[model samples]
Each structure stands twice: as structure tokens, then as C-alpha cells.
Target: MKKLFIILILTGLIYVTYLNKEIFYKYPEAVRYTLKNSNELQRAEFEKVLKYFNKEEDNLKLKCAQVLISNIPLYSYKKEPETFNQVVDSIHALKNKLIIYSDSLKYNKRMLKKVQDLFVDKMNFLCKTNDFFDKEEVRDIDTLSSSFLIENINLAFEAHYKLPKKYRTNFNDFCNYVLPYRNDREPLEFQKRRELYEKYSWVYDSIKIKPLEDIVIQIYDDLKINIDFKKLSNLNLSPTPSQIEKLQYGLCRDVTNYFVLLFRSLGFAAGTDYITTYGNRHSPIGHNWFFIMYDDTFLPIQARSKSLIFSDIEKIFKLTNMPKVYRNVFNKINFKNSSINIDTDVTNMYRPTSTVQIENIFQTSNKEDFKLCVFNKKSNWFEVDKNFKLNNNKVTFNNVGRGIAYAVTNSFLEPINYPFYLDYKGNLMFLKNKNLKEDIPFNITRKYPPIDLPNKWKIDRIKALNNCKLQGSNYLDENSFKDIYTIKNFCSTQKSQFLFKKEEKYRYYRLIAEEVTSYTSYIAEFALINTDLEPIKNVKIDFYGTKESKLKQKSKITDNDPLTFGRFLNMKITFEVENNQNVSGFEIQARNDDNHINIGEEYELKVFDKAWKRVRKEKAKDTVLNYKSLAKDGLYILHNLTKGKEETVFTFDENGNQFWFGVSDVNDLGVGAPMSMGFK
Candidate 1:
């Protein structure tokens, strides 16, 4: 039973590590396309919330971390294995629900990959089933588990071999192409990454993140501060992740790549979106901005800056911008005119990029009018034998059909968001530009989805900003939760050593320590403040130092909304430890409000332990000075430093309980603050 439990635990941890590695790697094509397309385009009104599916990396990671810890069984073989089975059932239910709604659009390409779909479904089942193999797992259960694990691991590889055909990465060139750009040049780390195929074969092969944010979220959580180069690189455009890693500041594409890379390193899923103006016979060449979803909320991430962007990317695909666009939809339009056939062969008629093409005067008469006529894509403008005026800049027909053509031109750019979603197959394929839909409507469908998909939630994305704001908090940020270290994680049964630096000089310094209180109750949030002093910025920071301190017991630094002079800068803490251990808290606080000013005078308060030897920082010189106490039984101390000078100072006492005058140490005094205090 013990052996079974140990193996299950180790296996689970190993699987988690495998998942993290995949999250940490970023593909280059995904980098460029996501930045240029996703950033520049606006999404439909749907604000999605399933974090992993959202593609905002931080949100996805948070969701993933929560799931990895939530309701997990203590042992696989426990008598009530039903509890374990229930958790597995819930995860599978979530996964299936994702499929139906994630690609709920009428024309989703996600439904196209049949073999891929089945493979993923099977893999999900095997993974969920693996969670049930605990100590109560008997020989029959062991046989079933072993068969499932081995069979799926092998089956996963066969699906892997077909990925090159699906995603376009030639198996051999892929790794070699990415190898040189990795963040760390260490040989072993490179090998571990390069040999990623053997470790988790399916990840390096087969699969893609639609909308992009979902993938980025998973990667961000796993990598956290340990982000790598591949995530921020564009192998197709920049051709190397190293270029992105080496850059300090960059353009919209560069910033986009950096963010996507960072998110992937932390173990979140992500999706991408790009844009291009029409090019001669091809699609758009020029394009603009970005959007991502994470933590169940969509983010119109600014691919251009560290800041976030609001809904600004025009979701329009311009056919007029195409260099040589065909004007043939008119060939299919039916007209009421018997002589001027609307179905006339205008197949060769096309538009130009350099100059406007027009049939100026095919008629013989100017005003006396040899003939009156018009042509339009909607076929409603083919009216003949009608009173029409043709001037240098004005062409008007008495009928309203001419006005309809103008409206169609403007409507092309107003298409719905989902039709432009990254995985959408439905797009505007214009037959003619500027012809106006005299009869036919523009090839645009601006409709809403029936549902928000998976779930509906308010995700904080960058809202429109006014010009006057100083700038702060977006809906997303970073976390510092590293996985728990155990015997297998660490080579030896030992605590990790951490060296903290108190980088800034301050007026006061103090270290604090506290104990762990409950099961799975790690530090959720922590912050040091200037509770008794004035506020200053950019002071050196570090937690307290105590050799006996446990790693999991130490408070973690976070960037979500935590206590700070500025906007919300941190969220949850990363500290964790067993509740059974006797533990104490550790914090290093320092204040140097006068670092930029001259200190002329200072004062100090001294609390004494009954023992004469108990004095704080005893190495300083002792000065002879007047001593006083609020009362004989209350407290007593001496005022230090000369009068009429403002100087930064520190206060500390050896609390065994003897009071003393700091007359010997000139460094221990403040001018006006000491004498007025009464013993409490």
C-alpha cells in the first residue's frame, strides 16, 4: 500500500513537471502572427471567462494552479476511492464542455480535425483515469492502470507523427531551428529541452491554441520569473527567439512576442489574432494591434506597449486595398434591363492599385445623351433609359439605387468580431470594392453568438484611457508560486538556501518572523509598510534572515494588488509548509526617508531587559546623557544625539527587560519625539 501511494504521488508530480515544460516553450510563428493579428483586431462583444480557454496566460496559470491543488485525493488507494473518482469526473466534464462551446460558431475550423479530435479526447480520458490508481488499487486495478498508461503513452506518439502534416513544422528542422535561440545556453538544460520529445512527445508535436491567450496563460504560470527565449521569439519574421530575448525595448510585434513568450514560460494556454491590407492579387499587406484571453477574460493586449489597449483594432478586412481585385460578382447579378444584360461577361473587369479604372464615355453624346446607363455589383444600378447626370465629381441617378452602392462600401469594414476570430472560416470575400451594394448587401455578417461560451465573466482588460492618467493596474500581472520541493525534487532532505539583500539604506530596520497556522494554508498575501514613519519610494527590499527559517514559511513577493504607496502591486503570496512544524515569520523592514537629505540631529529610545548586558546594537559607542522615564514602574530610556538637527536613526532593544540610557551612543537620538512619550 505504501509503495503504491509513493509511486502515484511521484508520478503525479512528474506529470505536473511535464506539463510545465510544455507551457514554458513558445513557438515562433505563433509569436509573429499572434502579435500582428490578435493585437490589432477587435473581438466580438463576447467576454469569455474560463481562464485556460481565455488564452490570457496569467489567468490560465492561476486557473491551472488552482485546479492542480483543488480537491485532490491524499492517497489513491484510500478506502473511499469514490472521492478520487469524483474529482476525475469533474475534470472530464469540464474538458467536454469546453469542446461544444469553445468552437460554437457556425463555421468553426476546430470541428475539421476528426483524427486530432479523437486523439485529444482519448488522451484526456487516460489522464483523468490515471488519477484513480491509489493504495486501494488492487492487482486487477493495477493491470487496468498499467494498460491504460502504456497504451496511451504509445498511442500519443502515433498521433504525434502526424503533426507535421497538421501544423506545418517539419519534424527534423523544428528543434534545430529553435535550439540556437534558447534563453539559457547551458548544455544540460539545452539537452533537457531538446530531448523534450522523448519526455512528453505529444506537446512538441500536434496541436495549436486558437485565439492564443489560452495557451499563453498556461505557459506564464509555469514559467513565472523563469521565462525563456523561445516564448518571445519569431522564427519566421525575426527567425530566432534570441533576437527577442536580446532586445530591451521593441515595436508592437516585439512587445507582443515578449508577452506571449513570458506567459508560455509560466504554464498557461494562449491564442493569437493578426491583420493585413489587400495586396494586388493577394490579401492585405499592411495590418495593425492585439487581443488575448486569460483567467476567463479576453484581453485586447497592446502588442505595441507594456501597457494594455482597449477595443481599438478595426475588425475590417479591406478589399479595396487589394492591388488587383476582381469585380465579377456583378456577372452573377440579374437585372430587369433586357438589352443591357446584368449577366454580361465582366469577368475580365478588375480594379487597380495605381489608378482608378472607369468607363468614362462609351456613349456618343455628352448632355444630349447618346445613352444613359450605370453598372454596379448589386445589379440594381443597371437602370437604362433613365434621367442620370454625369459630371466630373458627381454621378447621380434619379432612382435611389445609386445611393445603395455607397452604403455597401462603408459597411464592409463593420463586420462582426467572431467572423474575424482567429479560427473563423467565415470571412468577407468581396466581389468588388466601392461599387456599393445597389441591390446586394455587403459581404459582411455582424451578428452576435447565442452564448458567451464555457462561462461569462468580467475580465479586467484595458479600458479606454483619458490623456490625463498617470497609468497603473490592468486585469493581469505575475505570480511567484514555485512548486513544492520534496525528497525527489531535492536531492537531499534539506531546506533550500536563500540569500536576501537589504539593498537600500533606511532610517530604521527590523526583522520579523511568524509561524505556519493551518493545513494547505500558505501565506496568501503579505506586505511591509511604513506604519509609523513617512512614505518614500525605491527603498531596498528583502525578507528577514534567520538560519532556522523554513522556505515554505517565508512570505512571497507578488505583483497583484497588495499594500503599496502606488496602485495595487501584488495579489497572493507563494509561501507554503506543513502545519505540524514549529515555525516563525521573517520580515526585513528598513526606512531611509532622509537618504536624499542631510541629517543634523537624531534621537533614540531605549527599552531595557532586567539584565544589564541586554542592549541593542551594543557595539556602538555609549554616550553619557540625561535619563528619564514616564513613571518609575513603567519604562526608562535616555535621549541620544545633539539638539536642533534632523537626522535618520534606528531603534531596537534586547527585550529581556532592563531599561538603559543610550547616552553612550550618539547615533541613537531624535530631537523632539522622545521626551513627550508616557509609559503605556
Candidate 2:
């Protein structure tokens, strides 16, 4: 009788196990396979998470089971038993956290429904594509990956539980929009990248202990302290937490990624908002900043302590031409037509005004109906307004609020990549005439050789001559002159003025770069002026420099000149001289001080051979040091032995023989230049 009873009990136990096979099955082989590949930290973390899940309530486990069974479909996992089991375990682990956190808030049913809907929507997007996976049986592996689903689940629960009670109903439906992990790059398996975030859990824990406002402040402070902003190569690869922590430096995008991931790991809603490029010509690159949901309001957090105002963000960054601004989200945005390729990852913009006009549509017909779709970041693309229709292949989207949006036809869609900001007048202004003549003003300043001239070198007339016919090998020869207009004496003071006689046409003009010095003549700011004394519009003015002066040659500047001023050493203007223009008057200003010092009573001058081996020292008798007897290419030094001031001047004489002046100081004590010696 005892043996018969034991046999019956064993049969009953086996029947119960077989009946609930999906929930009871454990893959010892898969566990061992994962353990063999994982490192000590990964194994420890996985076991820790598994243990936590094992402690969850029976009801929570059943809820997870029901969710997977209803949405995942048994047919989807028929062939991939190992992937199915792993996914089931990961989901259970995630749900365990959700139940624990939700229990603290007494479990709102409305929020729970919203969370489930988000999970289903995200899962659908992930499972829709099989291109990333190789095996047919495991095609849905990406959706099941712990990094994708479980991480998102964790985020959804945190957003719902921590969201203020007032916003519970209005925001409950969109909680999942802030949960997914898709960035600028394509969707990737989170399982492989989970270990990276786990390494930085300590950072999340530190912030989690603080109050809401304190938490935000702590996050900003911690990031500022830890991450240094440095551009890195191989930006295509999204960096792991360990990599970012070790490198300690990254670009704006890389740093923003780090900030978002760090916040998301701790269950805080964070994302990046950026301009593709600045509208203002002053800035050539785009900019990105952290956007955090704080106190039920979206605020832009910068590296500084002060909070950034949305309107001022445009002005502060000098954004003039924002083609499209994008706010990043984690979930996939599905448009009405799959055939139309739109960049769905970009969903939010920072537009605060009505300046962005959507125009220039190249459609088959102007009368065809079109819709402007704006992404809500939740799940669907909401239409802007029915009034926005295509008229003459254009439509102006005025006062368009901040979001990722596109203009679409039944069969086509075009993404608005840049977010346009309104000018002071509250109108979307196209960047037309970036090169308008009114924008650039006339500027004439002294050039080189003699950057400063003595006040005594006075000339009666400065000529505006043009229509040059060049003499052989010399454009400034006496034969090159065709027409010359000599104005009365104006080159006496530092600033001089001249007026062009009425109705003069000129292809070339000449102006003094510097006053006549013993060594060379320097010139700059040669321009063709209009009757209003403004620079003539759009004329290519070519500049040439030479040691020779046109005054001595009794000729005009030539067109085929070879010598051009080095941009770094001197400023040269290059505008085409406008013909048949009359100048009211023109002004020329010399440099404040001649870069070349007069040596007069300041210091004693010395000359050395090119090698600096042979030295010829001389005492300055007057303000100026005469170098007529010195060899060309000689090294020169200025010494104020009394004041312990000594420096080597690097200048060469023309033709191996000429006087050179000191322009700047030098030091030979440490690396290359000379240094100062304190007076004893």
C-alpha cells in the first residue's frame, strides 16, 4: 500500500510541472554559457539582480507572465526557446523593480495602464525590424534584450512614480516617451551595453538620496566635476560608461550622451536638445545642452549655476539661421506612411517664436493637399493645423511651437531639420544677402615697414590715379600713368582726408601704407570709395607691396604686380575697384604707435653676425640707431644695461645691407626668445 501511494504522488507532481512548463522551465545550459562569457563584475551584478527578482511577490511574477503572454504571442517564441527564457527572466527582473517602486505610491491604476501601453508601443517598434539580427529564430532578440526593454521599464516606472500629483493625469499617457533609449544612432542591443551603466550605479545612488531640487543640482555639479570637455576621435562609437570615466574628456555630443545615460540610469527624465548649426554667421558649428524635467517643467541646464531662459538661449548662442533644432527621445516615432523616410529620432525643437516659414515644396501639383506633422514625443505625429496648405508649392508655419515636425503628402514626407527662431520683428527672415554692401563699413589703417610715421613728413597732394599702362617689368614706372587727380595737402597729420573729383573711373588706386622711412615703404587699406565716402560695392581690389615707391618712379601702381603682403604680418584689402564712381571724401589713419621703437634714449643697440658668434656692440648716441654700415641678415639685439633690459630683435636688411629697426621685444633665456633681467 505504501509503494502504490509514492508512485501516485510522483505522477501528480510531474503533471503539475508539465502543465506550467513556460513559467517553470529553467535553462541550466544557457546560464552556464552566460557565466562562462561574463566577467566577475558582470556575473556578480547579474546574480544580484536575479536574486532581487526571486524575492518579488508571487502576484508581481504572475503580472509579468500575463504581460509577456498577451503581447509577445506564443508563436513568436516557438522556435527560440533560449531567447524566450532569457527575455522572460529579464522582464521579471524589471517588473520586480516597478512593483517595489509603485507600491510606495500606492499603485495608481491609470499610471499603470499608461506604463503598459508604452511598453507595448516600444516593443512593437523594436520587433518590427529583423535586419539587425542574423538568426531567423532569434529575430526578435533586440526587443527582448535587457538593455532595451528592462532599462526602459525601469525609466517608465520612475517617471510615473516621481511625477508630481498635479500632472498625473495630463502626463500619465506620455510617460513612456521619456523611457526608451534610442539616441541619434540606430537602435542597439542594450544587453551588451548594460554592464557599462551598472559600473556607474554609484553615481546614480549618490543623487537618488537627495531631494528633487538637490538631485538636479547634484547631477549638474557631479557632471561638471567629473567630465572634462574635450573632443575625441572615433565619435561614431557610443562610449561605454567606463570609457567616458577613464577618458575624462569628450565633445558636446559625447558629454550630453554621458549626462543623459547617467540620469536615465537613476530613473530621471533627461534628454538632449540641439541646433544643427547656428543661424548667425559668427558661429560655424551646432550646439547641444541638457534638458531635464524638473518640477513638472522642462528647463535647459548648462554648465553654469544660473538657469537658462528659453528666449535668451537663442540670443546667447547667437543663433541666426537654425535650419532645424531637434529634441531627442528614446522611443521610436512612427509616421503615417512607412514608405516615406523621415528621421524620427529628432522630435523636439527649441522654437519660441513664429519666424520659421515652411516653403519651397517641389510637389507634382500645387493644389494637392498636404499635412504638416509635428511629433509629440509620445507615440503619434499630431497635425499642426488644417489651414497649413500648399499654395504655389509653399506654406508658412508661423508661431510653430517647439517639436520635431515635417510637411508630408500622401506618398512623401520632408523633415524640417533646423528650428528657425524669429527676429526682433516676430517674422521668419531668410538669410538673404549675407554679403550686402551695407553690412560692411569702410576701414583704412596703416600697414608695415613703418607702422608709425613722424608728424613732420608732410606731402601736399595724395593722388587717386587709374588706367595704368605698364612699362616693362614695372607697373609704377613713369610710363604707367593714364590719369591722376591730386587733392590738396592732407598727409601731414596722423589722420588725413581727400575728396575724389566728380565722375572719375579707376581700375586701380594707390595709398600710403607707411610714411617714407629710410629702409622701406609700407601700404594698406587701398579702397575705391563712392560719392557717399563708403566703400564701393563688390569690387575686387588686388594689393601689391614693394620696397620701391611710386612717388620716386613718377608712375601709377601696375596690374601685374607679384609681391603681396603676408596676411599674418600685415592686413591687405582685396576689392575690385568700381569704375566711374565719385568719392565725396576719404579718411586715412596711421597706427597709434610705430611698432618699430626709435631706440633714441631707451636702450643701447648692438649688431651680431647671422650665426650670433661675432658681436658688434654700439651705444645709442641719439633716439635712432644708424645701421648703414651693418651687413645684411645680421642678428640685432637691444640692451638697456642700466635697467637690465636686453632682447634680440629678429629682422633682416634688404640686399644684405640696410638699417633695421626694433618692432617687438624678445627673450633668449628659456626656450627661443630672450628674457628680462632684474636690476641689481
Instruction: Specify the highest-TM-score model's number.
Output: 2
How does residue 414 of candidate 2 score in lDDT?
A: 37
Tens-place lDDT per residue, model 2, 1-680, is: 99999999999899888864533234233333343445565444433333334544533322222232222211122132233324334443554566687676664434444443443344345455563222334222213433344444554455445544432322322432344443343223355235534554554445445544555565455433232222222212233343344333345665666666555455456677775443211123456666666555665654432332344443332222333456654322221111212222232244333434465533334554444443222212234433355555566544343211233332233333221223333443221212223222221111122211111121211111111111111144434433333333333223233564554554544442222222223222233456676656655444444323434221222221112212111222223355445544444432222222233324444432211232334444533344434433333344444333213233332333222221111111111321121100
Whole-model alpha-carbon lDDT for candidate 2: 0.37
TM-scores, in order shown?
0.18, 0.35
TM-score, structure 2 vs. true: 0.35
Q: After superposition, how far is residue 197 of candidate 1 from its true place, in Å?
A: 5.8
Instruction: Supply the global lDDT for candidate 1.
Output: 0.25
Error of 1 at 382 (Å): 32
